[model samples]
Target: MFEGHGVNRSAAERRAASLTTRRSVKKAHQAAWLVNAIRCIDLTTLSGDDTEGRVRRLCAKARQPLAQHIVEALGLGVVTVGAVCVYPTMVPHAARALRGTGIPVASVATGFPAGLMPLHLRLEEIRWAVDQGADEIDIVITREHVMTQNWSALYDEVAAMREACGPAHLKAILATGDLSTLRNVHAASVVAMQAGADFIKTSTGKEGVNATLPVSLVMIRALRDYGEATGHRVGFKPAGGMKSAKEAIAWQILMKEELGRDWLEPDLFRFGASSMLGDIERQLEHHITGRYAASHRHSPA
Candidate 1:
């Protein structure tokens, strides 16, 4: 799945030891191998295809309808809805619709992407989304504060979002694109988990650079190590830029190779992507049709 592993255990180990200790390495590798994904896409699916002309409209007219279509298309199946990543305002909409299917509706909150808003507003966003029926909240740690090395405010914000979540699952988006290195990403993952994140995600899916095996590997490694230190098993969601089924499988391959086989399910792995559905569809077609054909949306039978 992962094309092939270039995992230098020695290199990975050296990095992992910096965050906590060598103990975290085992499971971290497992997570990296398994939960190869938390499949997701944003509100753009409400309407429009991927074209420059629709760029404005793609962001527009998109709301609950788009999410519902994806839900219906997913139907009840083995492939899974992963988690529906929507704006805080749409969480309730997704929850009401996807309820009983066991598909968690994840709302991106706490002033997603930019992290420019006040903590109270962000907390309110998370609280409101939970009120709307979100089973999980994908939150952004304060990137501005993190950039400033203002650990106080950043940790406070993460803790605040943590408290606001109150039993709802939390996936902390460190927005790693802003962070400078794999070391920084590893460190962020550890801090986020220590501050109470149930999962450490790589991006907001808004940035130019999104999830990659290298970045994901670092975060997963961090979580694994953190788990050993504290006895908590964190999850991973590598959002944005996951473009194909091959890539999705590569994540699985990475997990299987780097960590092991334990972290391969929806509980541990998630692929955050809007484009993945088509890729999955195409692959599914190759299975059913005997040849690879173009893919498109079909009503859920």
Candidate 2:
């Protein structure tokens, strides 16, 4: 449907900027928003040096994203992140750590970050991660497909990856930074949904320009259109470069205003971030005690 879709860069920037400036939440409401952000975060650890120990620690954080004191102070019950995302090899570690926590283990498969590997091998990677107990699979798309406007090729690749996921939910990472234009981002979003992606992600978090407000806006609009046409609900995740509770609120506001409150839940929205939780914790503490704690007080996420 987005064959010759046009995206006005200036208008997108203006609208994105307005979301942050025009909306404000305070005190208890801000704290509530921050807690919701924690619930919708895909706590991630995808570095080259990721060890079993690090993955286990990250899962522990995912299970209890907020401090016990913070949870008690906020009068909350059992607050945990939406999922624990790790490399394919680290899925076992995360799964074991979060075994009884009811949190899903997500793995980045299909030649993640660049997705330059052969198609069959990439599909095999998805099956392997699923075999290793990944409840969700985040696969990167071939940016060349979008750049070349080969929608059929993009849909076929993503459809193959979806089939390979078995019972695992599939998240298609568009790596919008590399797509080169907002129009490409929108087209890619539609094609991925058509191919059966459970979620359309903004980036792999490895791109120089990962997730940005304007990029997310374009993707969300595409998702809205898809949901309208097909009556299917696909999730939206803005991964990378989003750090701070302010961004957490901004993105949630975008989802709420554009798609309504249903998109505010963890099932339909997530922040693909590792360090974003730390800042959110700091903000919650400030709301409770009227002073910001040292950043060190919040454990590494």
Candidate 3:
């Protein structure tokens, strides 16, 4: 059954609150987890001022997220981010910069952040991004569909967008903050996955309320249930407002608890962030030297 399951808001709230209160990895273990978090970051740049040069620099950073010295001190080799995300117009720039690096280039399409454009135009944007050598496409679902309880319409739209992605992976951004209720968020997650979303993402980063623990609990449970029912695993991405190393650890703990360690990989979980990498790097430096570096020392660009 593809119907959405009901969510208990109070219980979900309790669980979310507990997630923050629970102490997580620390010292060396925390550093190691931060390294893993770095590997799972979709280092993103989605500003209106984005340019080809900016996208290229973002790709370069993705290739070597940590300084060579830091990587060597950690006893690691060439630790790169999961992917470099950019706008459709900069896909070619990112592709050119990341070629032969194994790291994929992800482009946000389907009128991202708003997704209020016409369906045909949105699908066309996906095709264009893929054609421009985007290995993954982050698409925003039409919030109006979910708001109006138009599940079938939402399914059809996401299915078409997935098809438009062709060989490239499709990540459906639910814009959960705009979905009104936890039940609506659950329903949208189910509909997107049923229609063929490779991953169900939380926010567009433009939302006023983005990527909260309570909302994450709702969506991840949906992922767990979908996996149990269909035996098909889908990925989860929590974007926006996830800035600190502590926030990253909280999300990692959520995945570990709900879906086990198998969901911890870059393929199954990703942090849609741009500033997050800098903080993780800073914390890793502190782990090594007991002193945090200046923010500019770990700039994303």
Highest TM-score: give the candidate number: 2
Name the better of 1 and 3 by lDDT: 3
How much does candidate 2 score in TM-score? Answer: 0.99
Please give the clash total of every predicted structure, in order. Answer: 20, 0, 0
User: Relative to the unseen true structure, what is the C-alpha lDDT of residue 285 in candidate 3, on a scale of 0 to 100?
Assistant: 92
Judging by lDDT against the true structure, name the best candidate. 2
What range of 10 consecutive residues in model 3 has the weakest lDDT sum?
Answer: 1-10
What is the C-alpha lDDT profile of model 2 across 79-131, one tens digit per residue?
99999999999998888898888999999998998999999999999999999
Lowest lDDT 10-mer window, candidate 2?
92-101
- The TM-scores, one per candidate, come to 0.74, 0.99, 0.97
lDDT of 3 by residue, 104-212 (tens): 9999999887988999999999999999999999999999999899889999999999999999999999999899999999999999999999999999999999999
Q: At residue 259, what lDDT does model 1 achieve?
A: 57
Q: Whole-model lDDT, candidate 1?
A: 0.63
Clashing pairs in 2: none
lDDT of 1 by residue, 1-301 (tens): 1112234646765553343322232333432222233233332222213333333232222222222333344342233446666676655556665656566777778877777787789899999989888888888887766656666666777888899999799989888888876656766676777778887888887888988766777777776667677778877877887777657666666555555666666677676765665554555444444566644343210
True-vs-predicted CA distance for residue 115, candidate 3, Å: 1.0
C-alpha positional error of residue 86 in candidate 2 after TM-score superposition, expressed in Å: 0.5
